[model samples]
Target: MEPADAVTPVDPVARIEAGPEGPQIGVFFDLDGTLVDGFTATAHAGDRIRRRQARIGEVTGVIEAAMRYRLGRVNFAKLLERAAGYLRGESLADLDAVGERLFQERVQSRMYPVMHEIVLAHQRRGHTVVMSSSALTIHAEPVAKFLEIDHVLCNQFEVDAEGRLTGRIARPVIWGKRKAAAVQEFCGRHGIALQTSYFYADGNEDIALMSLVGHPRPVNPRRELAAMAAARGWPVLRVENPGKGNHGGLRGVLK
Candidate 1:
């Protein structure tokens, strides 16, 4: 007689909600430096920066300015416009393809397993998972798909009919308050309550989003964010070098 089928197919969404009795939680994660160790897309963009093939530093400077603006020190619109200007005149297909290739080859491999497990654990607990990044949507979307994230909040580029890049953002750039805006819109559309959500990020630029969530945690945070998180009494997680047995709170679940 044939043996009874014993394998069970687990539902990721259901698994993500298996935590202690409470309202369903939504986990929003920042892509660079939070989920992953570094900025892969930015590093790839650096190639164009170094070659002067593009005004990458100018764009980056604007990004930095935008971060500062989020901290209430500058004009956000001006910084965004300046950043968009740097990408003018590029072929969208070429830039996107190059970025995708570089990201898959050099960046994807460096993903920390502990971080991956944390994402999965949240998923298994039935939490709605989102990947929010300052990178262009072309890059962030693929990474989101690869990680099976439920949603993505990222920047979009305008492309002409000929597939050439107009170097203008198709929508408001997703960073800082823009990120918080995107999250708010998403929650509104999905009927999700922001008061019960969670957000994880590592940089000073993400403070707006961190403040928006009910449960905010800083994971592998930068020095500035670390200080802020401590002052706010938020949890700080360190997952680097999991093999050496330093996974922090993730150890129990991982084992």
Candidate 2:
């Protein structure tokens, strides 16, 4: 199947706003595990596969291959091609509708309180808040709307002439170093300074993203990332569980 045409560019004013100090502060957040807790949107896709509601395993396998390729165990282009082949005939409207329902039902309730607070704080400070995730942008959009973030950087599925999915991505999948590239592109286009930006992430795989920002914080970090944070002296924060006063240096990190 032929790949779908690129999505019409969203207007800049619709996605970003000029701050009083002219983009002095921009906050970048990684969605899974950083903002939301326990579950990820990908898991919802897996559930759909199990229920036979979607042929998502084909895409999931491609994602795994891409992960292996990132770790230098496989060929990158081949993996992307293999993954893109999965959506060659899906109805775009139906996939989007199902994805929205899955996001609301399975992913919305898992958000971390501390992460929500941090996002709100950035908004209050007049900073441009953006979310980046490996999940499809369709899946991320509802959450982004709910959080009132300024923009989202995520993978996009290509659609055919009839508005059916071509099972291909319009852009390279947003992951690992590619995520950093997306951020740079966004910053360049928006005239935001990278060195004044803040990034929050939970895994070492996101180290490239962390390194790009002037201020990087590891939030509810995985074991390996937490260790790396300690070695690098980057601030570490834990999402406060219910009934637990904020702890683990989150208060200071936000300040």
Candidate 3:
């Protein structure tokens, strides 16, 4: 099916008109706020680095970028770039270890049960499930492993022959439009139908890819995302944090 040029609303859990055993379809998910409340592993990794090296400027940049990201003013590419730069001379292996530790310490507990259930449902239905994010490989890989997702489309850092980080990001840094492009490429390679695929995300930056999918579900969306979801008639899902109970009102609207 051709990619849609217009935004269309859809039920979050509506099934396609396929039979018990249907054609191949893909279910894409955004990493940060959609599947998990937020991605704190990156922050955790950076903090770990800062504790040893103590670069105030780098730490401050991270804080500023994070704030901008939370405000929806910073896109994933920019955020990933900044985060990668902080580990300029660090070893890739060390960063990978830190990434795993950060995932277990900070990110593992933040996953939403509702989102996990949705992933399982799609898996049982034989859909290809993928985690797409602008987060670097170090931060995204562990989470994908924990979720048992086999495919991932995310940003990566450039490393030297010696396996040291070069403080630069690999090409096509997965962000807004770039992320949409990656999903399209994946569909082309796997013979999946874009018109029948699903994409669930929470960030406003995901609109490009979300619009391309047949079903776009916004989970605990931000202000702009919530407004767009309502305007487009896209389904909105609310999942409480693992420990937090029901939080009502506008604040709850944007998790």
Q: Please give, for residues 1-255, the per-residue lDDT of candidate 3 as tens digits.
A: 222323444323334323133437888988888777777555565566657674778778888997998777987677877877887888989988888888887787777776776777787777888998877788888888988899999888899999998888999788888899999999999998877888888877788887888767778888888787767767666777774754311122211
Better of 1 and 3 by TM-score: 3
In candidate 3, stretches whose alpha carbon ends up further than 4 angstroms from where it belongs are 1-23, 42-46, 68-76, 245-255
The clash number for model 2 is 1
Q: Candidate 1 — number of clashing residue pairs?
A: 10
lDDT of 1 at 226: 75
Candidate numbers sorted by lDDT from highest down = 3, 2, 1
Candidate 1 achieves a global lDDT of 0.68
**For candidate 3, what is the lDDT?**
0.75
On lDDT, the stronger of 2 and 3 is 3
Tens digits of lDDT, candidate 1, 58-167: 75686688688767787545554565567677777777777677668766765667567767778766677888777776567656777899688887777788877676
Query: In model 3, which range of ten residues has the least summed lDDT?
Result: 246-255
> Lowest lDDT 10-mer window, candidate 1?
1-10
TM-score of 2: 0.75
| Candidate 2 C-alpha lDDT tens digits along 8-67 | 322212122332333557789888777776435465557657788565576568568858
TM-score of each: 0.73, 0.75, 0.83
Segments of candidate 1 deviating more than 4 angstroms: 1-24, 49-86, 241-255
